[model samples]
Target: MRLRNHEGTPVDPVPFLVVVGLTFMFVLSFGPLYGQALGAGLELSVGVSFALFLAVAFGSYYWQVWTARPETVGVVPASVRAVRLFYLMLVLAVLMIGLAIPLML
Candidate 1:
């Protein structure tokens, strides 16, 4: 998707993820993976983890969109951009999860 800001600069499409993610999860069962994730703490940590997952997932999507192909990705080749966003989300997810370690401890 070609994302344009009010000023018309191409923008990273992370915010688009909420609609896409929810729609996807709605159609497909979030399943045991979701259960296992939420089973922890069941209170504070659950919320945190959910938020973290959204952050990471969005990172994956835009990253993928960016890196796929210029025709597919828009503005530029998508694979490289997509890969970058993926790694950005990965690193952020790791960092966020790492932050959670202290709470778990």
Candidate 2:
């Protein structure tokens, strides 16, 4: 089934799924380090991770809607922006995970 945005345009779920999945993996991998870095406990780290996941999910949805608007049609397609955003997030996640690993040792 297809998802519809605010404009009622059909949205491809792939990009959103990829982003959410990456975010989930990142949280699982980095949540503990996040807590350690901030001097927080397990509970606080889990809470923060949950909040971050929600924020990313909603933020991506809104970003898709904004990019898919008719006014931005001539500039860049929403699909392209979604792909670019996915790669950007992937790079950032890798960097953060890598940085966290050294700290874990």
Candidate 3:
């Protein structure tokens, strides 16, 4: 029921989400578009929000990377696939929380 890459690899959700988040933030960082997107808000406010989002996305993405290590998820003596998944999850979580700080400022 899912799609797999030509190399027989499934799509990595964590990275996929991170990329999307980054793209969104990048677009928002533009001055004219930023103002238009969030009308009536100060420029600094938009910048801060974008910064926070960038932080969260970065943090979580890295967290998942650590957790997804093959050695870390060797609990069931499985292959590297499971390890990758674990790290992916961890990365996503960190990214989500890390993005909040700059936004709050």
Global fold similarity of model 2 (TM-score): 0.66
Per-residue CA lDDT of model 1 for 22-92, tens digit only, reads 43453233322344465644454545555666666666655544443333345656787889879977986
How far out, in Å, is residue 23 in model 1?
19
TM-score of each: 0.33, 0.66, 0.33
lDDT of 1 at 75: 60
By lDDT, the candidates rank as 2, 3, 1
lDDT of 2 by residue, 1-105 (tens): 577777687777777778788788777667766776779988888888888888998888777643455454559778998998899979897888686777767
Of models 1 and 3, which has the larger TM-score? 3
lDDT leader: 2
Show where candidate 3 strays beyond 4 Å: 1-41, 70-105
lDDT of each: 0.54, 0.75, 0.55
In candidate 3, residue 39 scores what lDDT? 62
| lDDT, candidate 1, at 5 | 42
The whole-model C-alpha lDDT of candidate 1 against the native structure comes to: 0.54
**For candidate 3, lDDT tens digit of each residue in 1-105?**
332344444434555475656656553544334454456467666676677667766665554443334333346656667797799779866865665454555
Q: Which prediction has the highest TM-score against the true structure?
A: 2
